[model samples]
Each structure stands twice: as structure tokens, then as C-alpha cells.
Target: MNNYLIKTENISKRYPIRKQNARPDTLVGTVIDFLYKPVRNLKELRNLSSAQNSDYELESYIWALNKINLKIKNNEKIGIIGKNGSGKSTLLKILSRITKPTNGTAIIKGRVASLIEVGTGFHQELSGRENVYLNGSILGMSKSEIDQKYDEIIAFSGVAKFIDTPIKRYSSGMRVRLAFSVAAHLEPEILIIDEVLAVGDASFQKKCLGKMDDVAKSGRTVLFVSHNLESIISLCDRVIWIDDGEIKGDGNPLQIVNQYLETINNISESQIDLTSINRDTNSSFQFSKLIMMNQNNIKSSSFNVGDDLIIKLKYSLKDQNLLKSNLQVKISIHNSTQTEVLNLNNEVSGYIHKLINKEGHVVCKIPHIPLGEGIYSINIEAIINSGAADVINNVGSFEIIPGDYFGTGVPNNTKANFYCISEWE
Candidate 1:
């Protein structure tokens, strides 16, 4: 059975710049209205404006959505992605009836339960329990319906202890989790979520995304918008690229993500000139750029299991005491959870303070980076005179990659995130 739960035609919804004005009409005014109304031509008065009523008037008034056309079948998962201010939230809002489109109509074919914004329509004065029932009814759930799912919502939200407390006192993450639980348990045929996943910390975000996976599997259409490319690729089957109120591309998740990345990286590398990285005239101490030495190792998008890597820092000192500076660099590597795996520093061995040679350009090398294959960033600082003055931190971003030294099948569903050449069993 082919079912199209949502579809849109060449649907157009237009509005004028000025609303039509009406005035009090007496019998005498009515007599004048009949005579002057013909001469006035009220239709002409409502013809948008001189330059504002073009077929594409989006230039003047913000066209939240323009000529959007797509047919989504039941249970389809559509992921929306774009840069900030690219109409992603606007599209979701239009579909949710939060706001009407300025120029195009969207035809939705199922009941929608949305968590576009946290604490939407939640009463600040109401307790958590009252708000749950209030929000549930707002989502079309009857009182009995809300009672049936109350326990599950509280459990999934991890707010059973606070379920009776006033939500006005809940933390940001707690509020988000509760709101999401209410929306998820409503069991509407269509679910739309925005970047709420980016609200909480890594672990809570993971739990929310996992819950969304189950919600989608229960035969509900999902339209999710997120900036996390990793999450988007992992969760979405098809991706839509919306830019400047138009659909740029729609295709497989990975391809769309790769295209978006290439576009962003190219712009970052091109438009943001890396040269002239810094300028500080006080005491003559400054660093310009920090980047990976062998970028080709990373550019190919593949890494071997045990490849040596180095992070290079390029800076120039106008004038300084090279020996008195006593340079030091601190580097920390973190996992996906932002948990520190290693905090390698040259302070203990005094290697960092040792690199104060004229300060034109310097490279800090992690002799043998003891970590698995994954994305990592550095926190760099330069301290002078026994941690007295001169400090620069996270100057630039770099990564330590795990090389596929062992020719094994692609790693999946395994905790084998690390690849080290150590003697074992």
C-alpha cells in the first residue's frame, strides 16, 4: 500500500504589505461610499505595492519558505540541514502552524507533535505534573490518554523525582528532557524536531537521539533539523539542504553531508586568510597560527593505525626576552564524551619552556601520541617567567587520527575505538 502522508503542490500563500483598512460607515457615508468606492477601486488599493508585489517579492519581505514541493510517504525520515539563518527553523514553524508561509502553502497529512522550542506553551506558574497534562492536552491527548502514558513520560525524562516539583525550577537540561518526553509520548503521526538535541550535554543528547530513533521506527514521519553532521548522517536516511528559502539539494545523508562539509571548509580555508594571524603590541609576544604539520595525512579522510603526528605553531615576536619567556605548551585529548583521555604537557619534563628560541616559529610534537583513532583538539598556552605573563590557548584546532594499521573490517558496534601497537594476550 502506497501512502503519501504529506504532500505539497505548487501551493501559494501570499500577503500584502498593508492590511485593508475599514472605517465607520454612516448612511451618509454609505451614499458617498457607493459613489467614491467605484472611483477608489479598493482592489487597486490592495495590490501589494509598486515594487513589492513581484512574483518573487521575497527580496523585500522575508519569504520564510518559497515554492517548497515534496511528497513524504508515511514513516519516512527527513533530515533538514543548513547554515544558521537558512530557513531551517522557519520551514518547521510553517509546517507546525506556528506561522503561516508568506508565499507557499504546505499540505500536511497527519497529526503533528512537535518540540520546536523547549517549554513551548508550558505555564511557568504550573507545577511539572500540571504542565504535563496541559502540554499533553495541547498536543491533542485526552485526560485519559495522558494518564495512560504519564509513568512512561516521567521515566524516560529521568524526572520522576522532580515530576511533582514546579518546572520553573528545573535546570535547562531537565526542562528539555521533560518537554521532549511529553512530545514523544503524544504518539502523533508526524514528529518534527529542531536543534533541541544540541541543548544538553553529550550524554543526554545521545539519549534523546536514541529515543527519537524509536519514535521514528513506530511508523511516524520525522523531520529533524540539526547541526551535528555526525548525528545527522547516522540517523537520517535522506537529507534536505535548505538555503536562502529554497531547497538546494536533497539526497542520501552521507553525500549531502560531504557536500556541505566541502562547501564550508573551502570557504573557511579561502575567505579567512590564515596569514597575519595576530597582532599585540604589548611586550612583543604573540603567536599567529596553530595547525597540523602533515595536513595531507588528514586531508585524504583516512588514517593509519599508528602514524606519527605533530601540531605546528607559527608566531612572530616583535621583541622579547627569549630565555626569560620560559615557553610552555599544554595539550589535552578528549573523547566523543568530552572526557579527557590524556593531558600531555611539557611542564613536567620542561620541554615546553625549552622551546623559547627567538619565537619566530615553533612546532610542538607529541613524540608518540598515546591514543586511539578519533578526532581530537589541542589547548595550547604559552607562559613566561614561571607562569607569570604571556599566555595563548586553543590558538588553532588540530586532530590526532587513528591509523588502520591492522587491516580489519570497518569497525561497528564495538568498543574497539583504540588502535595501539601494544603487546597483549
Candidate 2:
């Protein structure tokens, strides 16, 4: 008997690319296109042979996942990390039976509950109370079983007052809370969650993480995907990194996340242009540039312990009117081990900016660098009116050299992430 609870063999998925000018809406055109697809494919295959290149035939489709072979043991906590559109969600969809692979096979030997998206598996017209039973039944749970755990789910969700309310009227956070509560409490052998947890607040996200930890400790399998590297490093025992529809690295969580972060490092110059970086395009504002400097206000990437480190972030607004809204900026510092060492936020620091132009900059100053000797990376995020406008990871990195933080001139040699002043009693 195999101990693997999930196994995928050479799985590949492809979606046909539709031409922008192709008119397939008409029934006749649709029929003709359908009938001609086989001939077109055959011609493409012949062209592939003549051209001696497989890429010639792959122009008509995009491969979301390619030749992925994975075996997940029972009760393993696996974290999947990748850039946007890198096929992390596609792999989870395949494992959840929500989608089929174009080629290869996947075998799952346990019941699965997936919260891939907010409000997924929820009925808009049905009450939250109804959806709990509905999702439970979908997960192969009996009514009696749901009944036994119903109160627990409701209480965990913290939406008891709205349990009888329709799902359509529930906020995104509320829906995620109830959906996660149901999926986590129904006792499925395997649980798969995507980035949907980002919809909740900080407290709720912490609660959900705790619940996931408990579930994993109970000998259940968990496959999680998130952009929060800190959460990934803390919760997952193993991690798999996907890039360009293929597995890039798989193994220890910290190592894999660190490798991924290194690949995304975009700091090639003292001042980097952030306009062309990959990020969410729906936001009304975006970061334009990032500049790092030393205490002398000169561009530098090397700093000593207890030295003042300065950062300047430039941003632009799509609409000038948005300047009236409150803008918040955050900077996260992480060591080479992918562990977050410090987070600096304007809101937390009680700094308010009064902007008068569509383009402006924010400056953050660290009075004394507390980090030990090592290479560290910076991640930046901008929020407008409580909505995340831009988030760029590994925007830059700086080196921290040895310095006497305690002013003892003793040359404190330690591998710790940060150092603090100490005195003999």
C-alpha cells in the first residue's frame, strides 16, 4: 500500500488562445472553427516536424502547468509559492478536482475541502447558514456530522449575527470567514487554500492560521498558497516553487522561499524604476521608484550596525483626485533566510502626509540599524484609503557590516538577525 495521499504524474494543462479578431460568436462560424480545429492542429504538427521545433505548434495555446510530477505524503504541510500567473492556482485546482489536466494523471485518496477563492462553493441567494450545510455536503459530510460541528463553525467565523443572512449581502471578509470556518471544521482529510485569506483583517488571518496549524497537527494534509512569505515560512514544513508553468525548486520551506525571493530581486541600480515591475494593475496608484541612502544622504547599499538607514519611495496617482484619500506606505525587511525582521508602516508610526501633487515621495528613516551583519532585502507596499494599491517584493537589498552597536568596541560577532544594547548588572 502506498503511503502517498496525493500523487500527480506528468500533469499538463493548456488553454487555447483565441485570436482577437476571430469571429466565433455566430453559430456557423463556431461550427466551422470547431470542424477545422483538427485540420489546423494536424497542419501545425506537420509544421512542427518541418521546422524541427516543438514551439511552433504551441503558439495556439498557453500551458498553465507542464509535466508536473508530485507526490504528497499523508499529513504533510506543503506550501506553494510562485509569482502571479505562474500556475500555483492551476495546480491546486487540479488537486481539488475543480479542473482537469490536458495530459497526465492525478490520484487523490482522500476527501478534499478547498477554499480557492472567496465565496467559492457558496450560493449567492442562499443564507450563510444554508451554505454551511451545502458546503459540508459537497465535502461528503453527513447532516449529523455538520450538525455536531455547526456551532463551532459559526462561532469560529464570528459572523453568528449574520448566519441567517444571504451570502450576497455578506462582505468579502464575512464570506471568507464563514467559508474557511466550514472548510476547516468539516473534517476533510485534505484542505487546500489559496490567497483568499488576504481578504480578511489581521486578527482574522491570525485566527485562520491558528486553525490551520491545529488541523495539520491532527494528522491532516494542507496545501497552502500565499504571497506572504512570512506566513509560508512559519506554517509550512515543505515548499514547492513554480516558475513559468514548471517546478523550479521543491524542499525545505525557508530555502525554497529564499531562492524565490532572490530571483525577484530587482535592485540593479542605486535608484530603481518601479513603473515597469509586475504588480496588480487595477490600483489607482503605483510606486515609481525606490532610493536607498546612508546617514549622509548619499546613495549607498552598505550600512553598519547602529547606522542611520534612509529610504525614499516615489509614487504616482492615476487620478489626481485620489490625493484626498489617506495614503499609507509600508516597508518590510527580511534577512537572507527569508525571515521578516522588521516592518515599518506609516500608519503604525503615526506619520501623516499632506500631498499636493499627483506625484509625490515618502521618506522613512531608521534612527539606528539594529540588524546584524548579513544581506537583507526590502519589500514595499502602498495602501490608498485602506486598499492595497501596490506591493513589490525584493525591491532592493543592502548589506549590514560589523559595527559596535553597544559602543564597547568589542566587535560583537553574532549571526543573529538583529542586535541590541546590553549592560552588565
- Superposed on all Cα atoms, the candidates' RMSDs to the truth, in angstroms, are 17.4, 12.6
**Candidate 1: Cα lDDT at 261:** 58
Which parts of model 2 have CA positions greater than 4 angstroms off? Answer: 20-59, 268-425
Minimum summed lDDT over a 10-residue window in model 1 is located at 265-274
| Candidate 1 stretches greater than 4 Å from native | 10-59, 267-425
Give the TM-score of each candidate. 0.54, 0.57
Question: Considering every candidate listed, which one attains the maximal TM-score?
Answer: 2
lDDT of 2 by residue, 1-425 (tens): 89999999998877543321122546887799889979867765564343323234443455778899999999899999986667999999999988777778989998888878755568998999999998878766799999999999999998999989998999888888898888778578898988766778889888878888898889989999988888889989999999868999999999999889877653345688898886533446788999988889999888889888899999887765465567789999877655578999987999987545889999999978999888778889877655456778778888888887777678778877777766678
